[model samples]
Target: MRLDGARVLVAGATGVLGGALTAELAGRGARPALAGRDPARLARAAEAHPGAPTAVFDAYDPASCARAVHDAAAALGGLDAVVTAFGTVAFGRAAEVGDEVAEHLSAVNALAPAAFLRAALTVMGPGSVIAAFTGVVAEHPQAGMADYSASKAALSAWLRAVRREARGSGIRVLEARPGHLETGFADRPVAGTAPPLPPGGDPRRVVAALADAMEADAELLRTAPDGTPVVERRAR
Candidate 1:
C-alpha cells in the first residue's frame, strides 16, 4: 500500500525498533500514532512527531491492547496500517525458566501482539496492512532461549494463519524476522543472562527495509546470510 499520507499506528513505539520504524514511516510521509506501556515514554516518543497520537496499554491485558488500537485508529481518523514491535524475552534452558517468567514471555511475545493486530483488523480495511516483529529465533529455535523462541514462534504461526484468512480481503500481513540487532535488547532480559552472541545487524537498515516492504505490500522481511535485509513478496 502507498504510505504517503497513510494513517499508521505503531504499537510499542517507545521501543528501539518501533521508534525507528515510526520515524521511518513519518519520513516517508505516513502519519504515525505511537503506543506503548509507559505514558512518559509514549509522550516523549510523540514529541518527535508533533501531532502523532499516543495510547497506553499493558501487554498482559488483552482489552487494553484492543483499546490501544481502537484509540489510535479513532485519533488518526482511520488506520491504514498497524505494526507491533515490542516483546519480552527470557534466557534459560526450557526446564530452568520459572513458570511465571514463561507465562510473561508468552503474553508479551505472542499474545500481546496478536491482541493488538486482532484489534487492528476491526478498524482496517482492504488494502490496509498489519505487521508484527518476530525474530529469526521464531523460525530457528535456539538453546538457552527456549521460552523466547517458543513465544516468538507462536506469534509467527498466528500471523501465518491470519494472513491466509485476510488474503481474500486484500489486507496484507507482514512478519519481520530480522536476526539479532544491535538494539541492546539482550542486555535487558526479563529473566536470566544472555549467552555469548555474535555481533548484531544494523537496526536502522532493517527498519528502512521494513518500510520498503510495507510500501511494496510484501509479506515477509527477513535477513540474508550477510545480514542484509531481504523483502520477500511471498510468505512461506
Candidate 2:
C-alpha cells in the first residue's frame, strides 16, 4: 500500500483532519481526489492541490456516496486507497439527546463510512486499502456524548467484521482510533455543548502516523493524546 503514485479518494476532504491528510498524501506522491458535501470548500481544497479533482456528495445519502467514489476513481484513473474522514458529533446525555441529533450522528458517523467503504471496495482490488478516522471514544465511552460514542462504536464493529471478511483478499482495512485532537472538532458539535476536554493530539501528527501505517499495511493504529504512535497491531 505504498502511497507513492497511488490513486486515493479522501471523503470529507475539506475538514481539518481531511485537509491535512490530503496535503500529506500529495506530498507523499499520491494522487488524492477530494470529496465533500460543500462544493465551495471542496473547490478551495482542490485549488490548493493544483489539478487535484473534487466531488460533492452528501454523506447521509447512499447514492451520493457511491457516486462520489465512482467520480473519484474516474478522476484518478483508479483507486488504490480510500480514507473516510467524514463524521459528526453531538454532545449530550443519552436521554437528553433528541432523536434528530441521534439519527444524524448515526447516519454521518456510522452509515456514511460503511457506504464509502462498500463503494471504494467496488473500485479497489488486491493490495488496496481502506481507512477510517474513528476515535478513541469508540472504544472507551465517556459521559455526555453517548450518541456520538455509539455511532463511532458501530463503525468500529463494522470495520472489524469487514476486515475479517476481506482477509486473504489483499484489501487492507484499517481502523484508526486516535485520541482527541485539537482540531476544533469539539467546537463544531451538531447539537448540545461539549464539555471541557483534555488537550488533544496534533492533527498533522495523526495524519503522518496513518500514512505510515497504510504504507506498511498495518491493521490497527491507535495514537496517544499528543498524536504519538501508541499501538500498531499488524495482521497475523
Candidate 3:
C-alpha cells in the first residue's frame, strides 16, 4: 500500500517500537492515528503529530480493541492500513508460569491484535494493508518463554490463514516476525527474569525495512542471523 497520505492506525502507539514506527510512518507521509491503552500516553504520543487522532483501548477487553479500530477509522475519515505493534511478554518455564499469566499473554499478544485487525477488515477496502509484529519466538520457541511464544505463534498462525482468505480481496497481511530487538523489551518481562541474550538487532532498521515491505506489498519482514533486516516478497 502507498504510504504517501495513507490513513494508518497504529495500535500500541505508546510502546517504544510502536512510537518509533508511528514517527517513521508519519515521516513517510502517512497520516497516523495513534491507539493505546493509556489515555495520557496516547495524548503524549499524538503530540509528535499535531491533530493526529488517538484512541484508547484495554487489551483485556476484546470489545475495546474493536472499538479502537472503529474510532480511528472514523477519526481519519477512512483507513488505508492498520498495524498492531503491541504485546506483552513473560519469562518462565512452561510448568512454572501461572494460568493467569498465560491468559494475560494470550489476551494481549494474540486475541487483542486479532480483534483490532478483524474490526479493520470491515471498514477497509481492497489495497488496504493489515500488519502485526510477531516475534521470532513464534517460530522458534524458547525454553523460558513458552507461553509468550505460544501466544505469538497463535497470532502468526491466524495471520497465515487470514492472508489466504483476504488474498482475493486485495488486502495485504504483512507479518513481521523479526528476531529479538534492541528495544529493552526483554528487560521488562511480566514474569521471570530474562535469560542471557546476545545484543539485539537494530529496531530502527527494522522499522525502515517494514515501511519498505509495506510499500513493496511484501508479506514478511524478518531479521537475518547477522542482525540485518530482510523482507520476503512472498511468504512461504
Clashing pairs in 1: none
Give the alpha carbon lDDT tens digit for every residue of 43-136 in model 2: 9888878888788988668889888889888888889999999898899889999999999999999998899899888889999999998888
Q: Lowest summed-lDDT stretch of 10 residues in model 2?
A: 227-236
What is the C-alpha local distance difference test score of each model? Answer: 0.94, 0.88, 0.94
**Which whole-number lDDT from 0 to 100 does residue 228 have in model 3?**
95
Rank by lDDT, descending?
1, 3, 2
C-alpha TM-scores of all predictions = 0.99, 0.97, 0.99
Question: Which regions of candidate 2 fall more than 4 Å away from where they truly are?
Answer: none
lDDT of 1: 0.94
> How much is the lDDT of residue 7 in candidate 3?
97
What is candidate 1's CA lDDT for residue 13?
A: 95
Per-candidate alpha-carbon RMSD to the true structure:
0.7, 1.4, 0.7
Write candidate 3's Cα lDDT for 1-236 as tens digits: 89999999999998988999999999999999999998999899999999898889998888998898888889999999999999989998899999999999999999999999999989999999999999999899999899999999999999999999999999999999999899999999888899999999998999999999999999999999877999999987
